[model samples]
Target: MITGDALLLRPWREADAAELVRVQRGDAALRRWTGAAVDDEAAALAWIAGQARGWETGDRLGFAVVAADARNCAAEEGELLGHIALKDVLSGDGRAEVGYWTAARARGRGVAPRALTALTGWAFGRGLTRLELLHEMDNTASCRVALKSGYERAGVLPAAPPEFPLDGCLHACRPGA
Candidate 1:
């Protein structure tokens, strides 16, 4: 389990499937950002199982955003905050693409930035040289996360979405590059 001052980034477990489904359904922003469909039990279970397998094989690393307040969940079933992950890892280049989302209630609280910083630091420590974050041009919230996490604003990629007129900013962070 990877940790930070106010959050914990732990590997996914089978027990977390139910709570994860709740989180995903509850957070519309997450669904929009990730384009993940979690409308039914079967779909959610399939997604969770895929996450567990990815963790087991070292293909992808996923993290759950747990708040620091112990009583938060126990007393109030506290906020899930959201989730973050490093995907499409390239072993030879030591690079990975980062993605994240914040729960609706958790928005504007800097959850994304904090989780991003912690994840990127852990990735670099594990020998990842370059971390990349891409987002739709209109996603101002994500731009804030990238900027606050020390990512350099790289130029836009034309014809990115192909079907949609989605121009995006490619933010990058390369430690000791």
Candidate 2:
């Protein structure tokens, strides 16, 4: 687990499936960015299973963000703050893309950026050459997170908006950049 001052990033657990589903379902932000399909209990279960499979396959990894130092931000220690992922991994070339979401209660608290920064360092230390972050152009908050996490804007992808709506912005950072 990667520990931050106010958050911890660790592997997902079965016990967290319900909370994960709660965060994903009925969340407009998630739907806007991810078209989240974990809208029902069964889909949530499948999503958790898929993450496990991704871990086994070595192509993707998902981490659950929690309150660190037992802060008790939301009733108890290790409270769920959000989630982050490193996917579309190019193991041969040592590159990957990152995606993340901060829970409603955790938004504006720097959870996403801190989790992202830690994950970026971890991936790069494991021999990744670059890490990328992409988001809809209108998501200024996400843009801020990417920049604060040390990524530089690459360009806009005209094709990305059609699939998700709105133009897309790509940002990237090198291992030591």
Candidate 3:
């Protein structure tokens, strides 16, 4: 939905399965943060398929974060820089959760925060009024992205999800707020 000089956010494609597998296999941090099992081709395809299902069901919309130079190509047809998504989407509620993973090569390049900003703006344009981002308390980088993306600290949870067994902070942003 958004494209900048360094990165762009676009939908997932079936052909991206191979790149997903390759990136997941090479980046331990990505695997740890995303909890995606794309070490194998089958797993990567299944992961993409599930995201498609989520899209069809209106549960979420997944986007590939690629270099902005890849913009004119089909979604997910560029260098696999990372992934971002609006999860737990509820059209009636006008809110969703933001989540992301940046590839090793893309880290420290402002990819996550920029992607978050674009995703937040896109979701708001699509009728969502609120967006939330939650990250482990120790995940300073994720927290930075949330703040830089204009999310405010909302609250803290005593425990995070199984993938990240630690406390977490919840951040939120609203349109025109």
Candidate 4:
């Protein structure tokens, strides 16, 4: 597990399925960004299982963000601050696209930036030279997080927003590269 000052970055576990579904179900923002929550237990199980398989094969890096403890602003274990991960990683490219979100209840608390910084550290430690963060333009909060986490606005994509009504902005960053 990768430890941040106030959060825990760890692999998705089988037991997290039920609680994960419950946590995201009623949050419209999360559903818009992450897609509808799994309404059925079996589906949730399948989703978590797929995440496990992907991680084992190095196809994806999924980390659950949990509060350090009661004193931390983040949620407790069964609860999640959100998720941060690198996707579409290409071998020999030294680059990957990053995506992340904070649980609705955890928003406005600087959790996302902290999570991004932690993921940046982890990715750099693994030799990744470049990291990209993308978010719909409507998500100014995400934009702020990326900027605060040290990413520079690389460019914007028109009509890239799937759920939210906005364009998409791409931010790029690297660690000592």
Best by lDDT: 2
Instruction: Report the C-alpha lDDT of model 1 over 1-177, residue by residue, as the tens digit.
Output: 666656777666566667777777756667666788777667767887787777777768877777755554333233467778888774578889998877776788888898898999899999998999999888888998999999989878664454435887899999854
Q: Which whole-number lDDT from 0 to 100 does residue 31 have in model 2? A: 75
The lDDT of model 3 is 0.82
Per residue, candidate 4 scores C-alpha lDDT tens digits across 73-155 of 44336357788888866566888989887888889988899989988998999889999888887888888999999999999
Q: How many residue pairs clash in each candidate?
A: 1, 0, 0, 0
Candidate 2 lDDT over residue span 96-173, tens digit each: 999888878889888888899889888888888988899988989999999998999999987544576677899999
Q: Over the stretch 1-177, how does candidate 3's per-residue lDDT look in tens digits?
A: 567656768778788888888788867677666666688878878888888988899888998888866455444356778999999996568889988998887899888888887788778888898898888888888988888878999999888456568888999999976
Per-prediction TM-score to the true structure, in the order listed: 0.86, 0.89, 0.90, 0.88
RMSD values, in order shown: 3.2, 2.8, 2.1, 3.2
Clashes of 1: 1
| 2 against 4, candidate with superior TM-score | 2
What stretches of model 3 exceed 4 Å from their correct place?
A: 70-76, 160-164
Which consecutive 10 residues in model 2 have the weakest lDDT in total? Answer: 68-77
Q: Which residue runs of candidate 4 sit more than 4 Å off their true CA positions? A: 69-78, 160-166
- Candidate closest to the true structure, highest TM-score: 3
